[model samples]
Target: MNLKETQKKFHKTLSEIYPKSEIDTFFYWIVEDVLQLKRIDVSLNPDFEINEKDLKTIKSQMNRLQQNEPIQYILGHTEFYGMHFQVNPNVLIPRPETEDLVNWIVSDLKHQPKKHLLDIGTGSGRIAIALKKELPKCEISAFDISETALQMASENAKQNEVKINFVQQDILKLDSLPEDVDIMVSNPPYVRVLEKEQMCDNVLKFEPHQALFVKNNDALVFYRKIIELAITSSKCKTVYFEINQYLKEDLKKLIQPYDINKIEFRKDFRGNERMLKLLID
Candidate 1:
């Protein structure tokens, strides 16, 4: 069938599962990835025909999307911080809010001298790699419990042409970082188990749970450990976290006993308290 016919069939088949706008997005993304045609090309060349092999691949991806799989996983890559990143089930897809977190770090440290930075639970290496790209003079290291995630992060680092020291170590078990750093940043698993219902099926079904969830009673477990480690590590001058909005007060209480120079909370585009920065003296 032609591209227009394929588009209609794709929308009709998945209409119940996704909205028209989302379906349109998925269609264009698939078209560009599979057919090597831009969205404007599709509109300009309405009669464009996709070959049989390409048609089969498109249908297979549609089947997966019908099952609520994320388009990022289907495409095997996603745009984050204006760069392309490879993603899979082993690593969480990078989100726009995390971009805000990265910008926050860049704004704070851009004028400072070269320093070391550590990204805890750096799945897909988005935060670490982006910072390395932004602050080319700084040394960056990232660690994760999952070997597969670290592997993908390493690949992404290489793809982005940014060097990052990727290590496989669980933050929960680390009493201190392996290396001293001026900035310690993490967008750890802050989603509580009870909040699963609020997430869409695409995320719950396809994304790695290890990178997205925390127990209800210990929602801030990763934060707690990372903070303790940062506070104890003399060289870690600052700590950054992409946090759950509901637990802002809890996070403040968690850091209450620590010696900190300043604490700032910033909201995402949604106006939710999604980023936190703590300056440790």
Candidate 2:
């Protein structure tokens, strides 16, 4: 199949499940990965021929996407905060909102002295790895409960040429992090179980549920535990979290014990409160 033929097939087949805009994104992502070509190449050489083996692989991936698999998983990796990460069914694909959380932390610490960093429930090590890339002098450690997820995260760290200590420990059970950790970040499982209906079939079917969900009645469970640990640990000067968009007021009340002036809720570009920054005395 030629480039034009492959493009036509992708549009025709994927349009059944994804919108035209999303289909364009999926096509470009697959083209760059499979063909070692840029988006410009699709138009520059519409007649370029795809080898038989590569065509078969592309068609196989199209079949998977047709079956509701995420294109990131089909590609076996994804980009986050300008860095690529190896992903699988064991970890949740890093989202743009989480990138924002990472940016907030990096912006605040980019010029500061070296500090110890800890990321809880660091699926795919996206946050931890990105932080290490941006803050090369900082010591970074990331933990996840799943060995499969931790393995994928370690691979990503190596591929990115960043050093991150990946640990297989459940955040729900771990009461404290290492001392001297001046900054702590977590994008824990904050999506409530009841909110599953609001998600797309591809995410619900393909993403790792353990990394995406928390109990409906206890939506802030992870936040609560992590904050308590930060407070008790006494070494965490600042805490950053990718929070549930719907729990703004609940989070404000939950952290009441901390100085209100130091607790700030930041909204995502969508205008919902999606992150929190807490400074401890």
Candidate 3:
């Protein structure tokens, strides 16, 4: 079938579940990824025929999309901070705000001396890998409790041509990390049980919830533990986190006992204060 005709069917199959804008995006992304057909090319040549195998692949992808699977997971990879990462159900797909958190650190450290950076609960190793790629001189290592996530991250590091040391350890049970890193970065599980209703099925049903939520009554569990590690380890000079949007003031107060007014928060593109940069005094 030709590209334009198939795209019409694609929109029809998915419009009931997703908006037309999203379906159009899916059509363009799959075409680019699979057929190497740029959007402009598709627009200029509406009758561009997709080969048989490609048509079959698109059908399969359409089915998955209809099932509410994320397009990134369906493609088995995603772009973050201009780098491509391998993603799966085992790891949460990296989000744009997390990219902002990464850029915040990279921009701050780009002109400075190389620092050792540790990423806690580094599912898919998005933060650590992006930092390493941007700041090549900096040493990067990441930790995750799930062996599956660590494996996926390791593959992404290899694919990105950046070497990152990935370790398996639960943040809640850490006595200390492998070595003293100068920077700690995390986008840990801060979602409360109550927030699930606010999330989409692609997230609640497909993404790894172990990396998304804490107990409803204890949404700050990972933050508290990591901050304690920062104090006790006395190694991390600064820590960056992509936090739950609703918990900004609570996070500020939670870290205040350690060092009052040492924390600064960054807003994402949407103006929610979703990124926190905590400095140890």
List clash counts for every candidate, in order.
Answer: 0, 0, 0
Q: Give candidates' CA RMSD values in order.
A: 1.0, 1.5, 1.4
- Tens-place lDDT digits, model 1, residues 1-281: 99889999998999999999999999999999999999999999888988899999999999999999999999999999999999999999999999999999899889999989999999999999999999999999998999999999999999999999998898898877755677889999989999999989999999999999999999989988888888788688788999999999999998888888899999998899999999888
TM-scores across all candidates?
0.98, 0.95, 0.96
Q: What is the Cα-based TM-score of model 2?
A: 0.95
The digit string of per-residue lDDT tens for model 2 on 185-233 reads 9998888898999999889999989889888888889888888878787
Candidate 3, 141-201: lDDT as tens digits:
8999999999999999999999999999988988875556898899898899998898899
lDDT of 3 at 109: 98
Q: Candidate 1: which stretches are off by over 4 Å?
A: none
Residue 172 error for model 1, in Å?
1.2
What's the CA RMSD of model 2 in angstroms?
Answer: 1.5
Candidate 1: count the clashes.
0
Residue 136 error, candidate 1, Å: 0.4
Superior by TM-score: candidate 1 or candidate 3: 1
Candidate 3: residue pairs that collide: none
